[model samples]
Target: MCPSKVAEGGQRGWIVPIGGAEDKENDKRVLRRFLELCGGDGAEIAVIPTASRLNETGDRYEQIFGGMGARNVHVLDFDTRRDAHERNRVARIEQASGIFITGGNQLRLSTILGGTPVAQAIRACNAHGIPVGGTSAGAGILSEHMIAGGDSETETPRANGVRLAPGLGLTNRVVIDQHFRQRDRLGRLLAALAYNPFAIGLGVDEDTAAFIGPDNVVEVEGSGAVTVVDADGLQFSSMAQVDGDSPVCMLGVQLHILTAGASYNLVTRKASAGELSTVKE
Candidate 1:
């Protein structure tokens, strides 16, 4: 577990972004780690299953967190935008020490939670030192620019291969993609970076997570690795010169593969000493 510390601006929250397919039946390491960041057994957690279509999604997490010894676990479920705006429903988020977003369709999460009271409350919760965790589609929406959906095929980088949309914007200047190596989504993540070369693209593999502290320090966890694509120093790119469907050509796009226990500074765009290993082109 990462040692907790006071973040910049005096905030004490944590942003735990897990790739999809965490082990729920066995160790439950990811969820347990989230609980630890949220103050362990004394934490009040709110589980948001808005991204999932399954009816039992919320119940499953509620039971899991309860079993983990959370002081209180409330599942926030809403069908329509109006439901997201309900005062009573939004109040639950304000009182929680931690919030967990389940996996499903990321588009559904932005559509239902966007511009609503619940979304605003969540932002406020994170701002005031409350730990927030999400997996799969839940992890996808933790950025300012989210990958809504995209082609999973390993094709040449193209503009149309991936789609981008507004997310919860819990963190700006970053884009997150989940189920990375498990789904072979490197191509899609590359395509996304082609469109927005200035933003950092993170492709998190299954069972792995990027624990981002309030101070902008990210620590890798789980069995898999986190792929960091930094296109800010790109030497060349045909993204703007070519048509929408044309293949993109980018050079000098730095790539870093961060394994468990590795640390990266999001603000400096640099990895910790000896922890940084470049992915060869």
Candidate 2:
């Protein structure tokens, strides 16, 4: 995994990627932690709800953040690519102490914010030690390589089982998959790894999150688990030999399942537990 870029005297913000369906009302362990990392009350938090089709998604999170003591909460919503250029909106992100992105179609988020000034601001926040968090599709957009979409019903390794798309590039070390176990996305997550073996595959379960620090250690939290796939030892892949979405053969892949309190070092490619499990890749 590539080391993340640094800023502000070699400091970087925490990148928190939450799987879909995080508990907003009850418990709210994951969201609350993100707020704490952002410096809690009075922090200027920016909520990006560009991915959702629903009009209320932005307001809903705005209320949530405000209710959680972020009196200075701003809901930055945009429709077309033109909206991304709004100087006032981009400035809010640039000055935000913390940023949260809501879940929806990841493609919409990428197409609208990718390469824009607003996206550039978000990256700056992270590099400057301001926490940037996202859930579901929001989580997918934080990585350099995002899982677009593909068949989720099966676990077979296929050349075309998953699609890849460019994301915000906040993190180049990992490819994210949300609502992982619930959606049976192991196949596609592994397929993404097969296609880009250089990047690690991170499959996060519902209500959970992976808080990756500048140190590249991911601290797992919330209910359910996080699946880490390391293709560093991959010996072979039949991607070139496959045709028409056919299942492909692969070898030497490692799998590690982690839960709350467990952590994984992205730099070392090692899980909290010493033993590394093998999948049928």
Best by TM-score: 2
RMSD (CA, Å), candidate 1 to true, equals: 4.8
lDDT of 1 at 154: 66
Give the residue spans of candidate 1 off by over 4 A: 1-9, 273-281
Query: lDDT by residue for model 2 over 1-281, one digit each (tens)?
Result: 22246754677889999998999998889988888888789688899999999999989888887778875888999898889988999999988999999999999999998888888888877887889999999999998988889878677778789899988888899999999999998888888888869989899999999999978899898998999989999999888788667987889999888988888999998788423233235
TM-score (all chains, Cα) for each model: 0.91, 0.94
Top lDDT hit: 2
Worst ten in a row by lDDT for model 2: 272-281
lDDT score, candidate 2: 0.88
Q: Candidate 1, clashing residue pairs?
A: none
Query: For candidate 1, which ten residues in a row score worst on lDDT?
Result: 1-10
Whole-structure CA lDDT of model 1: 0.84
lDDT of 1 by residue, 1-281 (tens): 11233456668478788998987777787788899888889989999998999999999998898888899999999889999989888999999999999999888899999878888887778878898889999999887888988778564677677888988878876789999888888777888888768788888988888899887888888888888889889888777887667778988888889987788788899987344445455
